[model samples]
Target chain A: MNVGELIERLNRIGALRYEDWRAWVIEESGNSNPTREDVNAAALAWLKDKADGSIWLDPEEEQMLGEFLENVVPKHFDGSVVDALAFLERYGPEIASKDVADLKTYLNSPTGLAMIEKFNGHTGEQIGEMSHFFQQESNQDLSGYQVLRELEGPESVGNTSGSLLAAVTGIMPQQPDTAASAAPAPEAAHAQSAPPALMA
Target chain B: MQELPLAQTHELELIVDRRNRAVLLHRGPELEDYLWAQFDPEHNGLTLFTEKGEPRNLGLAIPKSFSDKLARASTLKLISVSERLHAGRPRQISLLQTTEAFS
Candidate 1:
């Protein structure tokens, strides 16, 4: 199932599901067929909402959703694959209970990949072609992950810089008086103060 | 003055000399001293020095109501706006206060 279908099926029985997620999608986003990108954006928005305590979230369902995303979704976001641990670490604050990494091997075997392709909404012909590509190439010395690693070396490094961490990371922290040897920090300093709490 | 907590507090000090040149000093956690500031009177621009002497000015502007305070105040104590909003002073103008109290 695509993320949209997974969301629908999950809401049906109420376990491992986002209750009222469809209404929220329609009312707030006007998106009936949520794509992977949409789901990613929604998850980020939900995290902010959860932080604001404006929404109620069950721990079990959150863990289930996190796991489903980890297992089924490709790390490719914005046309790239980041390190798996980094991905988890990035989202860990939002998803507090899930262990994003799995020790189980062979989860992405040909059949499993075919299921993932279905989840990705691939046509039968695309799924068949992807399976052949996976087996024929994967049966060699390197796994599919290793192949991706070789292809996206620079992005996987995630060498974002420009702050104090830049000094430590060897990106050369910006000198206020000297020419900037590195790019300005990718983000402003983490906000020092928490938002004020107010009654809704 | 921004009071440093006795325990975990670090000190970043600004001292304006009689000649009207100001220098910021900081005793890092390791208790090592470093000079950390520069002011451009022509442009009314102020940039802080990184440990490496890089200039960092975030383009903060001081309103006249507050900027005027630096000309005469002999000694000033600062608390965050959240802590004491009615008496808050712009931190950038802090070093411009009359005859440095900590000099």
Candidate 2:
């Protein structure tokens, strides 16, 4: 999309909050905050390049663009490109893979391609839940439970304690009489003591 | 007792002689994490290793019970247990000639 059109869309999404769109422009371009005139000039240049089809995206650039359109735009922009780009810097990695895959699939569908101009939408909470479920299933294990049991002793501390600690505690109880047991007793003088008389 | 950095992944080699009833445990850098996970019991998703270097991915749901047993066990005794568990069994090659003869 042309820069002006892109910016206008972002503005509609509530991306452009201030009277001057300079902050949003700078963020989108990854450039230092520029003056209004500078932003206008950059925006015009970006638009011109797009119109001429001179903007060739490398693999990294393409991936970034795909991520931004599928994740950043739908989630952050009320409809605004400005707010979306800003949010992208922070929450980009947290984007769900499934959302991106779904977006690609939809975009390739005949119906989707027919109305490609109206394809902007968010996957919302469903994507988040899917990601959480996948992560949980992959990492489910018993080591933590075992560790907890060991730490809390064999009294069935339930699943809350670390297994390593439980095992250690179960194996190594403190010796209460270690000091007393270590002390040597003095030998009595056997010869000095008189022998007891035998009973009739 | 010194911790190795996660950047390095090491492979471990274990030898098992089922006929001789012997097991040898070998450790290198990569196997450190695996060993720690197995013995620690607190490490979730840890896999147990057989003397033949094959992983027994049996998810023992109750690690606490296993840890209790391990706690009372000496290092040598634990090694012996690991060896016995991993010892190879005779494979049945044919109906007429049983592999139990080799065992």
Candidate 3:
């Protein structure tokens, strides 16, 4: 799908990540990118579409996200968010509150936080794997959940909270002889559904 | 501690719910809103905060009755109670897992 279509889908599913957008833009425009400007403008237009649009991120929510990103990105996951100010300032002025609130709410919601907490518990090798995965051209646009799904492959995808926890917990440093096609651990295989995606 | 009014209360919700599972969401965020559950299970609890290094007045304590379900995530239920019933007070939160998560 084209970028606009991609954005619409991401927005609808509440899976949009600023890092993904910036990565896409940087790759397309070759630096001196206008992603933030365009995003700010689009956000203004989206808010103008409806004062209470569900997708906008207000300052309060932005601060929450800034804190979240401070902890997660730049290390476990690589790409963008140099500092909190640069992180928070990307949106346009006249930004309505809480359009962003919805985003932050969903982003930090319990399940998301739970899964993120699992990712946070990764070993140095796991961290390396995650960083490498995000930096890949094919993986840049995928959400953290999507990356996990891919790593786990379709066979072991876990849907429930227990299995989700197991799904994440089940991830370990694969033995060199471990086949990528081999099934996930018994706990992972026990989970039947997929959990939600997280923002970056 | 003496009881006092909280600056922000009753702000979290479970946006998605299955019988045994639910997704936790932080709602009506203020500039101070941010969750620091990173050191949890080690620090012994996941705390949401407003100001950095300060967790005052941001009560997201889960009710013990429901917190047990969470211990069962290994067993695989969602570990949820009713968000409305449990999240109404800062003094507690409740996550009841039923071994039916992902159902």
Every candidate's DockQ is 0.01, 0.02, 0.02
List runs of model 2 lying over 4 Å from the truth: A1-52, A58-79, A96-200, B1-103
Q: What is the TM-score of chain A alone in each candidate?
A: 0.28, 0.23, 0.23
What would you estimate as the lDDT of candidate 2?
0.28
Measured on C-alpha atoms, candidate 3 has an lDDT of: 0.30
lDDT of 3 by residue, A1-200 (tens): 22233234444543354333444444445763454555334433333343333355555544544544444344333423322122232221212243542434533667544433433333212211212232221111223222332232111111122333233323322211211211122212233222232233
Relative to the unseen true structure, what is the C-alpha lDDT of residue A34 in candidate 1, on a scale of 0 to 100?
A: 53
Candidate lDDT values, in order: 0.29, 0.28, 0.30
Q: Point out the higher-scoring one by lDDT: 1 or 3.
A: 3
State the displacement of the C-alpha of residue B47, model 2, in Å, after optimal TM-score superposition. Answer: 49
lDDT tens digits, residue span A101-153, model 2? 34445435664343332222131212112132322222112122122222322
Mind giving the per-residue lDDT tens digits that candidate 3 earns over B1-103? 6322121332322111122222332222222333222212221223333325354332333333233333332211111212221111111122212222112
Off by over 4 Å in 1: A1-9, A13-23, A29-40, A47-61, A76-107, A119-123, A126-200, B1-103
TM-score of each: 0.22, 0.18, 0.23
